[model samples]
Every structure is written in structure tokens, then in C-alpha cells.
Target: MQAPMTAYKRAWGEASAKLIRKELEKVRQEGDFSEERIAAALRRLGCGRDHGVHLGHGFYSVHTGVACVSGRVAKDEVTSKVHGAYAEPQPGTGPCVENRGGH
Candidate 1:
């Protein structure tokens, strides 16, 4: 027998979400949200150069292969979540994309 496609999608989504959360926490602790820092963090978490794009003004959009996780970066505040702007992420994906939604 074969597993359903939804199951695979959900698994990928969850993985993507987890990665985003993990990196975001580290970013928060570091207290730096510069473009370089954010991009490096996302890259460390498996985001390719093309996948992570800066939307300017501290806003960013990143696609982590299976799901999209994005948010804003500021000195006082930093936010990150999974937002399926480019494409609908599978169920269980987290939440933000600058151009799409969840800013």
C-alpha cells in the first residue's frame, strides 16, 4: 500500500515550520535582524538563495522547499511565520510572506 499525498505534504509542512521556529528563536536571542543575519539564519536552516528574498524595509519572504516561512526583522522586534503566498502550503504549515500576507 502507499501513503496518501496529503500525509507527505503535511509532513513536509511540519518540517518546514519547525525549521523556521528554530531559526527565529535563535535570531531573537541574538537580538539582530539585519538582512545578512536573517538571510544567514534561513540559509543555515536549509533555505536556498533564490528561496529567501528580501522585500525591503525589514520584510522578507522565504520558501523552505516544502513551505514558505517569512516575516519582518527589526531591532526591537522580530517576527517570523510560515505564509504560503507563492503557493498554498500543506496543512500543518506555520504562518508570513511580505508580498502575499501575514506580515
Candidate 2:
């Protein structure tokens, strides 16, 4: 027979999922809910995924549509942070900063 706790766990998981989905819907309605935006936010949480579909090495948040971690980072977060496929800005690829300084 299945453990009694198994049913409880399943129920909690389902309920949590529903709540998360609802929050995600709210976030989507607020503003740009694109993958890029979410990925950026996830970076702050020390989580990221390539292609915005595959879980790299951290947790992904559907509610915020962002990558997230369960708790505070314990060490050098910069080197530890994961970058999504398009998360990191390609050097010399951006049009903002340039050698063309205002003359």
C-alpha cells in the first residue's frame, strides 16, 4: 500500500502549482513577460536556464517567470551565477556603448 504521506505531498504539490500559475498570470498582465525579462530577474536569484526551457543548475520560478534559488547565496555569486542561452550580453555586440563617444 502507498504511504499515507504520499497523498498529502501530491495534494500540496498540486495546490502549490495552481497558486504559482495564478501568480504568473498576474505578472504577465503587469508588463513584458518575455523570456528575456524573466531570465534577467532569475539571474538575481542565482538561477538560469539555457534556451529558457532547460533547467541549468538552479530552480526556475514560473510565478515570477524568473529563475530563482531557494535561499541566499553562500559565496561568490558572480562566478556561481548561471547564465541562460541569451542571458549574457555578447561583448561588442551591443549598440549602446561604443568608441563613438560624443564629439
Candidate closest to the true structure, highest lDDT? 1
lDDT of each: 0.57, 0.32
Residue 92: error of model 1 in Å?
A: 28
Candidate no. 1 TM-score: 0.57
Candidate 1 lDDT over 1-103, as tens digits, reads 1123356555675677676667766776788766677778777866755664444466666655555556666656556665344443323332223223343
| Ten residues in sequence with the least summed lDDT for candidate 2 | 67-76
* Model 2 ranges off by over 4 Å: 1-5, 34-103
lDDT of 2 by residue, 1-103 (tens): 1122345454553454444444334434556455454455555443334322222233233211222112111122211221112233223322111123333
TM-score of every model?
Answer: 0.57, 0.29
Quote model 2's TM-score. 0.29
